[model samples]
Target: MSRIVIILACSLLLVACKSPEARRPISSKSGSFIDASVARNIKLNEKEQAYIKKIMSENPEEEYIASENGFYYFYNIKQADSLISPDFGDIVNFNYNIKTLNDDVIYTKEDIKTQNYVMDKQELFSGLREGLKLMKTGETVTFMFPSQKAFGYYGDENRIGLNVPLKCEVSINSIIDN
Candidate 1:
């Protein structure tokens, strides 16, 4: 009957409109798409790292220093004398401005209150933590972080996008030793 044909046609259309996840080709042996996704992520990460390095090289005036863990930084206001840098469990109060490698301002000191963190507490991004450890109170530094050291592949999911590198200028206001 005409009603039966109409129903079958609608059902066919519904199946054809299935979500992308349902339509994705599955691997015959593994039965999942994780391998392809991971490969794509790896490629993206490599591209991000190369881009950060190129940016650092282009800015000769900044005098960026590369660290073993892949973060790049240079002091804008170096600490004087033999001032002690923060150690584990020390609480630090600071102000910062964070931008993307493309120079898009993501956050600034004016956007929020003074940020504070306990040293080596994992309360901050890996690159920020590492840079802070090397700085003494009242010092300011500008740092560049590859995606892996900042937000990784997922990013902050808000101001930052996937695989995006970051730049931050931080001023250490005070350190409260525990």
Candidate 2:
């Protein structure tokens, strides 16, 4: 009787673990979110030029850093982990503002109380998601995300137009295990 009861319990547990939707794969239409023309005409402003120059000069190794799939470059990382084994899955809480290298404000959530956002490895763009994953909590890095990794080479027409260059200021606040 005890053996039969144990078998029944195991069977019930197995059945409970199955979800009808688990076997199906998520599908998305092609070109549903792909744009490649946004980074086409990027013009850097005086202030942006100054900052880029300063950072580039301060960190000569920056030029050596390879780019990801998009225009984003990981350079002069203040407190990044080693390249051999970088942390790419950590959850980073940060406050970011999107703008054009020309200092044109594109997106800002300054009114929010926390002014911070959480980024997951798979949830963000290829460049941004990969870039932030390389940093530790409390790490601050400035990266220029070309349209390819951003809204794609073609930008969101309602927000930024096609082929426009964009920049994002990122500051990692904390790391959370999601």
Candidate 3:
């Protein structure tokens, strides 16, 4: 009986000493979903860019400059005398109207109302935020943004639709330095 008890204890100790086994997932991902999404986004960006290019080409009278931040803009009222646009942390008072690429109005200046944006400190859309930095006081510029630059996959949750590019005319009333 004593020998049996000692053997059982030894067996139990040996069993407990076994290394933990790694678990095999029931289903493994091949990363297809992420790859497909990336490919789709790339294709979408290309199509939007081509369309914007067409619009620019068609409008020979309007001079549009492509921004480094992946948008296009032309000055309706350019202030050449101002040496610099609004810097970071500046309080910018502006008004803007939104439109589709086809020039369909989504939001009028009165509908949106005048905006007071604290540069790089407020919760504004990515494109408009970047666009504001390129504007001086009393300058109005019309910006053409790709969907990704504007709102990306999610629209404005109201009038704007999914993956819709936009044209916005922005006028800066004043820029108060912070």
Highest lDDT: give the candidate number.
Answer: 3
Model 2's lDDT to the true fold? Answer: 0.58
Q: Order the numbered candidates by TM-score, best leading.
A: 3, 1, 2
C-alpha RMSD of candidate 2: 15.1
Query: Which candidate number maximizes TM-score?
Result: 3
| Pairs clashing within candidate 1 | none
Q: Which 10 consecutive positions of candidate 1 have the poorest summed lDDT?
A: 22-31
**lDDT tens string, model 3, 16-118?**
9999999999999899999999999999999999999999999988999999999999999999898667888999999999999999999999999999999
Query: What's model 1's lDDT at 172?
Result: 93
Better of 1 and 3 by lDDT: 3
Question: Model 2 compared with the native: what TM-score?
Answer: 0.50
TM-scores for every predicted model: 0.73, 0.50, 0.95
Clashing residue pair totals per candidate (backbone < 3 A): 0, 15, 0
**Over the stretch 73-131, how does candidate 2's per-residue lDDT look in tens digits?**
45334654533213445455666667876667887747222332345434555656766
Error of 3 at 121 (Å): 1.6
Please rank every candidate by lDDT, starting with the best: 3, 1, 2
lDDT of 1 by residue, 28-69 (tens): 567358889888878877787788789878887887787877
